[model samples]
Target chain A: MEIIKIENLSKSYSSLKRKNNVLALDNVSLSVERGKIFGLLGQNGAGKTTLVKILLGLTHPTEGRFSLFGDSTNNYKNKKRIGYLPENHRFPNFLTAYQVLYYLGLLSELNYDGLKRKIFEALELVGLKGVEKKKVKTFSKGMMQRLGIAQAIIHNPDLIFLDEPTDGIDPIGRKEIRDILVRLKNENKTIFLNSHILSEVELITDNVAILHQGKLIKQGSISDLTAIENEYRITTDSELDTFLSKSDFVNFQLKKLNGFTYVLSGTDEDGLNKFVDLLRLNGITIKELIKQKLSLEEIFISLIKDLDKVK
Target chain B: MRNIFIIILYTLRELFARKLFIAFGIISTLAIGIIWMILANGSVMINQFGNANPGYDEMEKIVLGFEVSAILFLSDLFILIAIFSCANLISSMLEKGTIDVFLSKPISRTQLLVGKYLGGVTFVFINMTYLVVGIFLVVSFYFNLWSFTVLLAIPVITFTFALLNIFLIISGLLTRGSALGMIVTYFYFIVLSPILAARDSISNFISSDILKQFLDFLYYLLPQVHDIVKTVFKQILLQNENVQYELLIYSTIFLIAGLAISFFIFEKKDL
Candidate 1:
């Protein structure tokens, strides 16, 4: 079942000094299925945060409609089911870690015993078990981020929107957060993961959506979009500088290091054979040859760069 | 109703955790101490003044000093506390992004506004209760003019005025800068109303009686300075003089109107 559906959504802001109408989200449409971790990948100023805010009903869209669990954005019932952790999350500084979660539990309408158990469970889940009484003001950056996650999941929400969940976290903390997200996802929770960290998204997200310049440029299952054909790079020992001058391959680029390496992109068997034969005929012995697929980061950067060039 | 209780609890917990509550407590204590000292000293001076008259009633003299001192101290303390406590109530929360977390919940904007307003009012109640008790002891035990009804009504009136003023300031704070909103509110209640009430005859040379009456009307529209202190003064010192029902009605109206405006503004605010 489609848990979230946004149709033709747009958002803009206005002010006196300048009518700065930022097209934060531009007629964007998408839907997420139940029990799938959907990654929203974007660079800075790419409308990812805006779309999340609109879905959470923090900010109203200029046009179009969105619904959560088949209920409209304005519906309170839908809001009750959704949990959101905003970017650079900040809690009331004076509240202790336990107090923050307890407050959220109250807002979520949990009973006293239920709230207490849930708060403990959430704090333990986020690895903040013993310091529940510590004030949020004295917490470090990573601890604050964990507290943000704890509050977001305190009600055991069915759908969670985590914006840059590991933005400021160190590698160890980041791994812990990733583990928590995977655990939640395995429990059949629908998670909307928004971040510029492509690798983190690539690890846990079942599907991915790439947003660029306030528009959804591409979106599909991780395999569908990033599955490029296997390609080989062959580096020769001798200085075959003449290969750069000849344009035998259509989608091939060559570079000379200690020798020469021809990097071919397509998976044409005949073309590979012909190129190998030609290199042998030139008396160039291949030193190293490796076949590899493009990483998600490489694909993401190339796609966004291409989009930038188009604009 | 559950949401209201939750919000109130949340707000109270958050407020108590902050340093401002501690500061308010210390300030209220010092204020009560000051009031105690003045009443003690003023009673001595009043006795001296009565010594010359020879026929002056001792009870009447002591009651007059207690009434004057309690009225002045209560009004000033309540106004100061109201201004300082609520100056950044809404704007500071909005700035710190705590408001966003609350907004994302199932609670309505109006409930959040009311919760915050009542939270500040609760703090005022606690502070005023201490002051009321302190004043009651000094007036009744020292000056021999304390009444139970006056003790109860003094804090109630002060708290009512504080709520009205805090809500009004919060209404403005939601839309504009906190400092600017607070300054505008303080000037209107503290300076403008009193200046208009005095009606200085010199103003008659340049303005008509209609304009003067209009100014008086505006002054009355405000929560009066005297009303805040009258409960303690009337019962403790003025003997059986009761607080006017009309002032209570006016206070209720102001409190309701102030909260209504705050709710309206907060609903539209982009926090």
Candidate 2:
């Protein structure tokens, strides 16, 4: 089921003397499915943040329409099911982590007992249980990001929009955040993760959308996009220089590495088998044959470059 | 109703947590102490003057004048405080992005704006109440004056008028800076209103009836801080027989106009 459907949405800003219009979202339309980790990847100024803000109703679109949970942006009931973590995620400096969640819970109209339980659970989930009483101003950047995530999920929202969830986090903290997102996915919650961190997105996201210059260039399951043709890297102790020189392998452009290793890429499995057999017949002992799968970052960069070339 | 309560609670929490209430308390205490000392010294000086003079009941008259002046001065000071305290309350929230988090909830913009306005007004009311009590205790204990209820009404009305006027003008506009907004408001209240009120006094030297009439019209166009101060002085100190019904009517008009202006501006504000 499509949880969010944005159709041809656009926005621009105006100023004196000149109407400088930023095509923040240029007729962009996309849908997020239910119970999936949907990654929204984009470079800076690619309208990722603008799209998130539009979905959250922080800014009205200049044109087009969007619906959340099958209801239009003006629908209040739809908003209750959606939670948001802004890019910077600044809370009132005076509020502690616990108070922030409790306040949000109250705003969401949670009952007293439910609010208390949710606040405690959320703080614990985000590793903020022991420091719940510390003012938000005293928190480090990573802690603030965690608290932002905790507040976004305090009410157990069905759909959460997280913008730059791990922007400034260290490697271990980023891993922890990825783990939390994975746990949320296991609970069957829909998450829209917006970030430029391709590796982190690749680790946790089930599906991905790449946005470029205020437009979505490519989007699909990670498996589908990163599924390259069968390529093998063979490292062998036996010398097959004569076999490689005598055969059509040279014409096929087989790459030689370190005098004993050979790398070949082909679309057909039979071609790979024949190549392996020829190496074996030539008295070459293969120590390891490893298949190279494309990483999401590589695919993302390639896709964006392809889009740029086309444009 | 539940949503309103939640908003109110959040606003109150924010206000107290920011130490505004404590700051207001300390400032109020200092102001009342200074005014009380000045009035007491003035009264003593007036009594000494009357003792040295012959055939003049200057002590009673000077005491009455001192009472009137003290109440007037306190009322004006309270109004100034109210304006300065709540002027940037909403604009600052918007600028800081705190308002966006609240807006992302199911709450409407109107509810958020009204909640914030009420919270600020409530803060002003509480501070005014404290000021009133302090003035009462100081005046009654130190001067042997017992006009408690009468003196309290001046601060209450002046504070309300101050908040209403500010809410009318500042609630919906996109002000460039808080200091600029504050300076404009202060100048309008202190300099503009007084200059407009003294049209007749200036007209005597210039000998121009048209300019005097124009100034009279201008005086009626804006809020008259002096009139409010004078009304409070008459009701509290002079024990005047007739209440200033016209001034009360004019204050009500200003209050309604302010509310209407605030509503119109807030409705059109982008967010």
Candidate 3:
């Protein structure tokens, strides 16, 4: 089921210094399904934050519409089921970690009795159990980020919006965060994550959307987006040229490397079968043959670079 | 309603965390102790039977004037502190990426605004109550004079503070710069408020009818807190007085209007 639906959403900012309206989000539209980790990948100022703001009702759209959990952004009750952990978040410094959680949870409308254990559990979940009495001001950047996650999940909302969640976190902490996210997913929760960490998104996202310059360039399942077409890298004990020499294999155009392997692209399934059969006929043992796929980072950089060149 | 209380609680926690609440309590206690010591010393001197200390009635009149003005000054100091402390109430929240966590909640902008606002007011009220009650008790017990004037002054000062809070909250929402907020709040309290407070005197000094008309309009528009202070003291000392209901009514309207405008602007704010 579609948990979030946005139709041609746009946001513009106007100021005295710049008379021209700054288009933050330009006619963007997409939908996120329930029980999936949906990643919105974009660079800074790519309108990822702007789109999140509109969805969260922090700002109004100049045009188009969006709905969360079957309710329009205009209906504020939808927010009751949503949680957000914004980038570079800071809690009130004077409050102890426990007090910070208690106060924010109270705003989330969680009663004290209900939030009491949840608060401690969240702290422990985030690896901050023993330091609950310490003031937030004394926390390190990574600890603050963990506390941010704790507050975000403290109310146990069905949908969570995390913007640059792993920023400032160490590798181990990032792994812990990923584990917690997977657990949340297992419980049928939907996560709408906005991040520029392509590798992180590549690791966990079931569905991915790439946004650039306030426009969405691509959206699909991660596998489909990164799938390489008609391309395979094969490793064998004997090179392909040793079998064909200068014969009818001239049209094959195979690229050889390290005297034992070859990369082949633009070959159909039948051609692949014929090539494998030809190798077997020659008594060359095939070590490995695998389809080559682009990494999200590679795809993302090339996409933006290509768009820049096109303009 | 529950949300409002929650916000208020959050505000108190924020203040307490900053240690400002503790500072307020400690300072107020010290001030009360000093007054008690001074008055008790005077009592000791008079009880020695040959000292030059004034009698009970004279001491009462003298204390009425000195203590009243001193309390007024202390109240003014608290108002200034409240303005400085609470000035960033809205702007700070709207800043530092912290606003996102709040805006995504199931609460309205009005709730956040009112919650932070009332939090500052409640903090100030607690300190004010402590100071006012302590002074009342110290003066009555030591000098053998109990004046209800100090008690009556709490509401008047508090209502006057309500009027200033509008400016504080507005500055918090409108100007993201703390220095700018401070400047705007103090400008109103020091120059505009006093000008409006003594509008009648300023009008008499002005020769031009048009200028006098402008002064009159401003006087009626702004809160006449000076009038509140003067009347409260005069009534306490049983002096001849002219009490005007218009000051209280107009100040209340000003407070309500300022708060309403702040809530409206904040509700539509982008972040």
Candidates 1 onward: DockQ, in order? 0.38, 0.36, 0.64
Q: Give the candidate number with the greatest lDDT.
A: 3
Q: Is the docking of candidate 2 incorrect, acceptable, medium or high quality?
A: acceptable
iRMS for model 2?
2.1
Clashing pairs in 3: none
Taken over the whole model, the C-alpha lDDT of each candidate is 0.73, 0.73, 0.81
Q: What fraction of the genuine interface contacts, i.e. the true contacts, does candidate 3 reproduce?
A: 0.82
Displacement of the residue A214 alpha carbon in candidate 1, Å: 1.8
Candidate 2, residue B235: lDDT: 60
Which order, best to worst by TM-score? 3, 1, 2
List runs of model 3 lying over 4 Å from the truth.
Answer: A236-239, A242-254, A257-261, A269-287, B41-70, B143-149, B232-242
Label model 1 with its docking quality class: acceptable
Tens-digit lDDT string for candidate 2 (A1-311): 99888898887766576777667778888898999999999999998878887787667788999988887847644666777787776888888888888878887767887788888898888888899889999999989988988878888888988989997788888888888888988888899999888888888898998888887888899877776666667788876566556556543545677768876665367777887788788777889887756899999888888887888
Which of 2 and 3 is the better model by lDDT? 3
Q: Put down candidate 2 lDDT per residue, B149-267, tens digits, no spaces.
A: 44555454545455344533463355624666677777777787667656667777876778777888766766665655555446645556776656556656776676556656655
Summarize candidate 3's per-residue lDDT along A129-192 as a digit string, tens digits.
8999998889998999999999989988899999999999999999999999989998899999
- The number of clashing residue pairs in model 3 is 0
TM-score: model 2 vs. ground truth: 0.80
Q: Stretches of candidate 1 above 4 Å error?
A: A229-293, B18-21, B27-68, B143-146, B152-156, B163-177, B199-217, B220-251
Candidate 2 chain B minimal-lDDT segment of 10 residues: B52-61
